[model samples]
Target: MLAGKRILLIIGGGIAAFKTPELIRALRGAGAAVTPVLTRAGAEFVTPLTISSLAGEVAHGDLFDLTHEAEIGHIQLSRAADLVVVVPATADLMAKMAQGLANDLASTLLLATDKRVLIAPAMNVRMWEHAATQRNIATLKSDGVLFAGPTDGDMACGEFGPGRMVEPLEIKSAIEAALSDGPLKGRHILVTSGPTHEPIDPVRYIANRSSGAQGTALAEALRDLGARVSFITGPASVPPPAGVTVTRVETAREMQAAVQAALPADAAIFAAAVADWRVENAASKKMKKDGSGALPTLAFAENPDILAQVSQMTSGRPALVVGFAAETHDVQRHATEKRARKGCDWIVANDVSPETGIMGGSENAVTVIDDKGAEQWDRMSKADTARRLAARIAAALGAS
Candidate 1:
């Protein structure tokens, strides 16, 4: 997919820098020409000779190389690449980019680049979770910088929890997605996934059995088709897909807020199984069993109707708004009714009765209901269902 693409690869100071040579090989194997830039701190971890050798290009360093500076090489290098990639994007390097600091060649190139920038962050757990680093990450994301991974795993610092750089293959996949020009290119799609948890106390909560697998798969499919996906997810067994902006929310209200924040989308998919009610007077502490055997009474409040609200928006509504219905009986009839009640363009209805094993299972049988009629799809893997749905969405939007 990346054939004839030019990638300006920037290596940052981090233990994960050792993986960049493999990443370079992967990019080159995909027919992308790599121009490597080794940071001074990155040089301590891997030699410039190794980077240059793998990339088949001279490793650039030193912003003040007199020979290159005479020709404004930084400007030339920045503009020459189709994409700029940062491997092992250190906390310091991220902060520099967030603040638009150009103290070195790599930073200068990043600032000067006209193309999209993708970063794979690697750092210790505490550093990754630190407020400053998180702030920098948010800043960079808002500035349109793409992130592949700093996924959860064991870090080189002998710690764990979301600071590991994803493997080379994953980064390679992300780069391919970034360079793709598919049917949904330039479209912004919003997807909500998982089961929202309505807290009853410090420990207890109300939730459903949505594993988020189908929603994750849908986001991945949309991403592969070159759509910029804003994925708002709740607590679920499945993880979010790579190459999409992920927003984590816990409750129905929080999901609603996140959905509002990711507005003006070309399409919106409401796949989350949000709790219908929340405890109005939830306990701050865990509710204990009373010796008197008197059960505690909890007041219930209706959760926000995200699908209905978004579908019935007066302004700034998405061109295509899709909702999901997990019904136990009369799936098609109920789904058709839901489409009208929610004011959504389409409703993907599925029978999730225990007999069907579809709710939290890997396979799904769905019927897509729209103004025309109900179109039933045979039972298939969730991944396949997602791909089919994504294709339908692409065709629908294209015709729109």
Candidate 2:
């Protein structure tokens, strides 16, 4: 889908640079021509020769190379590609880019270029969330720059939290989505993802096995289409997408409240695996295991039905309301019934049986049910599912 498109890749100094080789493969597979640019500090993490080998072109460096100037000079390099991508965008590189400092070849190329820029940041979690870094991120967003991921996880530094670079496949999907036609521009979207943990006690809670990958990916895809997104997310394993307003919640109640406040959105995708029931009477203190040698009977109460309420809203109602149905049996039957019961426009159903393992795994097999009927998609990776779903949403929004 990205044939004839050119991507200028700027590698930065960070541990995440190791993923660049796979990124090159994915980009090439998508039919985008890749050109490599290495910063002086970037070379410390990955060699120019490795970049040159994968990109199948001489790596570009130096502000005054006679050969580069003979053809693709700094001016040409900046203006040549359809998009400029920074993998492992380190703290130092981001600082320079945000400030428009051109002290190195990579920064020079970026400053001189006018292409759409995408940065996949990777760093120590502390560095990523530092006030200075956060401020720089805000500056970049206001400047209309794009960002893919700084997904949360155990970092190479042994600390766990946000600030890991998005996987190469994730970055590739973002580029493809960006290059696709912008039919969904000016549309407003609402997406919910991750698992909501409903507290029963100080140390325990009710939760699900959602990683929030699918919903987060959907948010990125929608953003690439020029849609404004209000991403209300539950406590997720991944950091929220950059450039999107993220409302983080820990329970179904919080998620519901956040979603309602973000109303009048053009479309709503209820992808979060919200807990169905919460402890009716949560203990103020940790419940002691009594000598009775009996387990505590936890009373459960239904949480707010976020999807149904939004679907049935009267004031500032969204044009589209999409809900999710996770079924272990009768996937089609349950999904069809859910569409009607929830009063949603559609239901994306999946089997979450332990044997299927689709709940927490990266791959997904979903059957979309609407008034017309059901369409079962072949099992695919969640990232691919996100792209396809994004395209479908774009097409539907254009029709409306």
Give the alpha carbon lDDT tens digit for every residue of 168-269 in model 1: 988888888888899998788999999999888999998899999999999999999988888999998997888777778899999999899778799999
Residue 375 displacement in candidate 1 (angstroms)? 1.3
**Model 2 alpha-carbon drift over 4 Å, by segment:** 25-31, 53-58, 62-75, 95-113, 131-145, 152-154, 182-189, 208-249, 253-266, 276-286, 292-319, 325-392
Candidate 2 lDDT at 117 equals: 84
Model 1 gets an lDDT of: 0.92
Against the unseen true structure, what C-alpha lDDT does each candidate score?
A: 0.92, 0.85
Least accurate stretch of 10 residues (summed lDDT) in model 1?
A: 141-150
**Per-residue lDDT for 217 in model 1?**
94
Error of 1 at 61 (Å): 1.7
Write model 2 residue lDDT over 9-84, tens digit each, in one string.
Answer: 9999898998999999888877889999988778888899999999988888787898877775888988989889
Best by TM-score: 1
List the candidate 1 regions with Cα displacement exceeding 4 Å: none
- TM-score of each model, paired residue for residue: 0.94, 0.66
Report lDDT (Cα) of residue 235, candidate 1: 92
Q: What is the lDDT of candidate 2?
A: 0.85
